[model samples]
Target: MSARLYVGLMSGTSMDGIDCALARCDERGTTLLATYEHPIPPATKQRIVEISRPGDNEIERMGALDRELGHLFAKATLSLLSKEQVPSTEICAIGSHGQTIRHHPPSSHQPSEQGFTLQIGDPNTIAQSTGITTVADFRRRDIAVGGEGAPLAPAFHAAAFAKAGHTRAIVNIGGIANVSLLHSEGQVLGFDTGPGNTLLDHWINRQLGQAYDKDGQWSAAGSIRPDLLARLLEHDYLSQSGPRSTGKEVFNLAWLDECLADLSSPATPQEVQSTLAEFSAESIARGIAQCEVPVSEVYVCGGGARNSDLMRRLAAKLGTATLETTASLGIEPEWVEAAAFAWLAWRSMAQLAGNIPAVTGAQEEVILGGIYPGARPRTQ
Candidate 1:
C-alpha cells in the first residue's frame, strides 16, 4: 500500500498543551510533514486538573471537560492543517492519545474491579469537528489482556530509532519519565522510569508561581540538598522491576510532602526545586541501570530535554559517552510523542499491531486504537 498521511495528537501529563504532528507513513517507515503545539487555555487547564481527583461533581465535570478538550484538540488539528495548507481530506486518520486524567492499568489494580484508564477528549468529537478519521482510546485492549497498558511509545520509538549497528535509548521526560531502549538486534524495551518534570514542575510553580524552572536555570542556581535527595530516593518505585508503569497518582505533590516532612532543615524554595531536579535525574539514571542493557547513548526528548541542568546531571550520573535530544537524530524532540501517535494511528488503519508485548506486558501483539472517519480523501 502507498504511504498515508496521519495526524497524531497528544496532551501529555504536563497539561501544558496539545501537540499535533502530520506524518507520512507506510510499512517501511514514517516521515514528518509538519507539527504544531496548541497551548491549553488557563481556564481549561484549571478545570482539567481540578477534575483529575474525585469530588462530588467530578464525574459530571469530567464529562464536560472531555468534550471540551476533544474540541480543543480538533481546533489544534484544523489549525495545523490550515497553517501547513494540507487538506484534512488528505490525511488518513488522527491518532489522539487524549489527555490522561487517570491511568490505573489492571496489573496495578485489583482485577475484580474494572482495570480502568481514563483519557478525556472524545475521539468522536475530534472526527466530527475536523472531518477526518480519528483513532483513539489506545490503552484498553492491553489492560484487558493483563498488560500495564502504557509506555506504548516504545513501539513507535523502535520504528524510528532502531538501527542494525547502534543501540539507542529514547527517554521522554514529560510529566512522567519513560525510556524506550532500542537494541541493535531490533528488540525494544521500555517503561516508566519515575517522576520526570511533573513533581519538579508542580513544586517550583507552587513555590515561585512560574510555569516551570526555565531551562532549569533556577535549579542550576541552587545546590542539590543531599539529605533530601537521599530521603526521596528511598522510595521503592526507584527499585521496581521494568514492564512497570506509574502516573501522577504515585508521584504528586502530596507524595513529595511526605518526604519533605522527614527532612531536617526546611529546604529553601530553590533548594527544594534543586532537590526535585536531582531526584528526577537520580531516578532516571537508576532506571536506566536496571535495564541491564549496554546503553551506549541516550537521546532525551519531551519538555525536560530543555532543562540544561537536568541534562547535565543525567549525563554525569549515567556516564554515557554522548547525550543529546532526539533532534540530534534528525527528529524534532517536541514532535517525537506526537509523531508516535500519528504512527500508531497509521498502524491501526492498516490493522497492524502497534504495542510491544515485551514493553507493556501484553499477552500478544495487538492493533491499537479506535477509528474516526474524515470527510475527504487523505491524499493530494
Candidate 2:
C-alpha cells in the first residue's frame, strides 16, 4: 500500500492552542510532513475551563462551544492545507483528538459509575467543512470494554519508538502526564503520572498573570517547599496500579487549594510553583519505577519537554537513564501526540486494532474512533 495524507488535530488540556500535524502513512511507517498551532482566545479558554467543571446552563454552553471548536478546527486544517498547497480531496482522513473537557476513570474516585470521557468538537462539522473523512471520539469505545479510555498515546509510542532489544519509556507531559513502558520482551504498559503541567501552568497563571512559566523560569527562581512537596506526593492516586488514568477533574485548582490549606504556613506563590514542579517530576519518576522491567532509555515528549527546569528536575529524578526528546526518533516532541492521532486514523481505516489491551486493560484490542465520511465519500 502507498502512503496517504492524513491530518491530526489536537487541543490538549492546557487549552493553549490546537496542534495540527500532516503525516503520510502506510505499511512501511509514518512521516511528519508539516505542522501548525491554532491559537485559542482567552474568552474561549475561560469558557472551556468553566465547562470542564460543573456549572449551570452547561449543555447550552457546551453545545455552542462544541460547534465553535469544530469551525475552528476546520479553518485550521484548511489553513494548513493551503499553506502546503494540498487540496482536501487528496487527504485520506483526519484524526481529531478534540479537547477533553471531562474524564472520569473507573479506577479513580468514581467507583460505581461506568467510566466516561467527553472530548467535544463536532466531527461532522469538521468533515463537512474540510471535505475529508474524519475519525474522532476515540476514547469511549475503549471505555465501553472495561478500560480507562485514556493514555491513548501509549499505543502510538509502542509502534513508533519500540525496538526489538531495547526497553524504553515514552513520557508525554501535557496537562496530565502519561508514561508508556515498552518492554524489550514486547509487552507495552503505561498509566498517567499525575499532574504534568496542570499545576505549574495554573499556579503561574494565577500568580503573575502569565500564560505559563516559560522554560520553568519562575519556578527556578523559587525554592522547593519540602513539606509541600511531601504533601503533594502523598496523593492516593499515585499508589493505584495500572489500567488507571486521571484528568484535570482530580488535579484542578480546588485540589491544589485543598493541599495548600493543609500547609503549616502559607507558601509564597513562587514557592508553591517550585514545589509543584518537583511534585510533577516525582510523580513521573515514581510512575516509571513501576514498570515490571527496568527502562533503559526515557524519551520525553509534549509541551513539558520544552521546559528546561522541569527537564533538569526529571533528569535528576531519572538518574542514569538517557533523557531526550522524540526528535531523536525523527518526530519533534510537540508533534508526537498530533501524529499519533493521525496514525490512529490510518489504523481505523484499515480495520486494525489501535488500542493495546494490556496497556488500557481493555478486554481486547479494538479499532478506536467513529468514522465520519468526507463530503465526497460514497464508497469505502
Candidate 3:
C-alpha cells in the first residue's frame, strides 16, 4: 500500500498551545514524522478558560476566538512543515481536533441529540490557508449516532501499542483522564477515569501565579492530605462504569472549592495539590482495575506522562503491572494524541470507520469528521 502524509493539530484541554504533527499514514498505521509546539498567548488561554464555563458576551467572545484559533492552527501547520522542510503539496490532509470548550455527553441513555460538544478552530480557514484538505469537527458525527464521541485515540492505540497476548491499558492524562483497555483476547474498552491534571493545575495556578507545576515539583514537596484525597475520591463521576467522557466543564476550580469546603479541616494549598496528584493516580488505576480483563501493562501518555511524581504514584498503585510511556511503542508520550488525529485524517480521506463501537458506545461504526477541500496545487 502507498503511504501518504497528513498533518494533525491539537490544543487539548490544557490550552497550553497547539501541538502540530506531520505523519506518514498507511494501511498499517501512521508514524509521526515530526512535531511542533506552538504556544497560545496568555490572554487567549485566559479567554478559553473563561468561555469554558459561562459568561456574559459569550457569543462575541467565542466568535472572535474561533477565527483567531483557526489562524493559529494554520500557522502551526505551516511552521511544522517548514521545520521538516516538507511541502504542503506532499500531504494528503490535515486533521484539526480544535480546542474543546464544552463537552456534555448525555448523562444517561437519552438520545444522542440531547448531548452536544463544541470544538472551535475553523476548518474553512485552515483549508484555505494551508492548501490541504482539512478534516475537523471530528466528534459530532459520532455523537449524532449515539456515541460518547471521545477517547477516539483508543482505536489508534489498539493498532500502535497493543501487544498480542498481553492486556494493556492506555491512560491519557489530559485535563481529564481517560483509559483505553486493550484485552489480550481482542476486546477493547475505554472511558473517562475522572480528573487528571486539571485539579492540580488549577490548584497550583491559584496559589502560585505559574502556568503549571513544572514536573509537579510543588506537589512533590507537599504531603498528600488523606482527608482531602478521601473527599475528592467520593465524586460521583469516579464511581460510574462503562463508556463515558468528561471535560473541564465537570472538573474545574468551582467544583474543587466545593470539595475543599466539605473537608472537615482546611487543606493547605500545597497539600491540596499533592492530594490531587494522588487523586488522579487512584482514579486512573481504579478504572484500569475495574475492566473485565486483567491488565498486564499500563502505558501512560499525554501531559501527565512527564510528571515524575505522578508516575511514581501510578507505579505504586499498579502493583505487578509494568508502567511505561508510549515512547516504548515508538512514539513520544506528548505526541500520541496529535498522532491520533493524523491517523484519523488518514481514515477520513480513505472513507473508513474511525470510531470503535465497543469503546465509544456508538450504535455502529461511522466515518468521523467533515472535510473541506483545499486549493489544488498548480501544475508547473
Candidate 4:
C-alpha cells in the first residue's frame, strides 16, 4: 500500500495542552509532516487535576469533562488540518491518547484491585466532530491482558529511534517519566521510572500559581533538602523493576504532603521545589542504571527536557553517557510523544500491533485502540 496520512493527538499527564501531529506512514516508515498544539483552558485543566484524584460527585463532573475534552481534542485536530491546509478526507485516522485521569495499575499496594486505566477525551466525539476516524482508549485492552498498558511509546521508539550497534535509552519526561532501552540487536525494554514533571509542576503551581518552573530556575535557586529528597526517593515504586507503570495516584500533592510532614523542620517552597527536581532526576537516573544493557546515549523527550536544572542533574547522575534531546536524533523533544501517538494510529489503521509485550508485560503483542471511523475518505 502507498503511504497514507494520519493525525495523532495526545494530552498527556501534564494536562497542559493537546498536541496534534500530521504524518505519513506505510511499510517503509512513518514521517512527521507537521505539528500543532492547543493549550488547555485553566478551568478545564483544573477540572482534570481535581478529578484525577478521588473526589465526590465524580461521575457527574467526569462525564462533563470527558465531553468537554472530546470537543477540545476535535478542535485541536481541525486546527492542525486547517493549518496544513489538509482536507479531513486526506487523513486516514487520528490516534488520540486522550487525558489520563486515573491509572490504577496492579501493584503491591493495590494488588487486590483489578488493574484499570481511564483516558477520557471521547473518541466518538472526536470522530463525529472531525469527520475523521479516531482510535483511542488505547490502554485498557493491555490491562485486560495483564499488562501495564503503558510505556507503549517504546515500541514506536524502538522502531523510529533505535541505533544499529549501541544501546540507547529514550526517556520521556511528561507528568510521569518512562524509559525505553533499545538494544543494538533490536530488543526493546521499557518501563515507567517515577515522577517526571508532575510533582514539580504541582509544586510550582500550588506554591506560586505558575504552570511550571520555567526551565527549573526556581528549583535551581533552592538547595536540595537531603532529608526531603531521601524521603521522596524511598517510595517503593522507584525500586520496582520493568514492566511497571505509575501515575498521580501515588505521587500527587497528597503523597508529597505526607512526606513533608515527616520532615522535622519545615522547608521553604524553593527548597521543596529543588528537592522535587532532584527526585525526578534521581528516579530517572536510577531507572537507567538498572538497564540490563548499558546505554551509550540517553535522549530525553517531553516537557521535562526543557528543564535546565533537571537536565543538569540527569547529566551529573549519568556521568559518561551522552545526554541530548531527541532533537539530536532528528525528532524534537516536545513532539516525540505526539509523534508516537501518530505512529500508533498508523499501526492501528494498518491492522498492525501497537504495543510491545516486552515493555508492558502483556502476555502477547496486541493491536491497540478502538477505531471510530471517519466521516469521509481521502478525496480521490
Q: Write the per-residue lDDT of candidate 3 for residues 51-162, one digit (tens) a residue.
A: 8888899999999899988888988898888788787889899999999988987654455448888999889888888888999999988888888888799998888888
lDDT of 2 by residue, 1-380 (tens): 12398999999998879899999977768888999998888888888888998999999999999998888888888888888877787789999999899998677645666778899999999998887999999999998888889889998898888999998999999999999999998889988989999989998888898988899999988999998888888889998888889999888888889989999999999999999999999999999999887777999999999999999999998867899999999999999999999999999999988898787889988889999998963221
How many backbone clashes can be found in candidate 4? Answer: 2
The best candidate by lDDT is: 2
lDDT per residue, candidate 1, 97-141, as tens digits?
999988887656665876668887998888888888899999887
Cα shift from native, residue 171, model 1 (Å): 0.5
Residue 303, candidate 4: Cα error in Å is 0.5
Steric overlap count per candidate: 12, 0, 0, 2
* Ten-residue region with minimum lDDT total, candidate 2: 371-380
Better of 2 and 4 by TM-score: 2
RMSD in Å for all candidates: 2.1, 2.3, 2.1, 1.9
TM value for model 3: 0.96
Cα lDDT of candidate 3 equals 0.87
Q: After superposition, how far is residue 208 of candidate 4 from its true place, in Å?
A: 1.3
- lDDT string for model 4 (1-380, tens) is 22388888888888778988888877777788899989899899889988887889999999999999999999998889888888887888899999999888765346677888899988888898888899998898888788988989898898889979989999999999999998889888999999999999989989899989999999999999999999998998887787899988888898999999999999999999999999999999998888787788999999999999999999999978999999998888888888888889888878898888889989888889999987644332
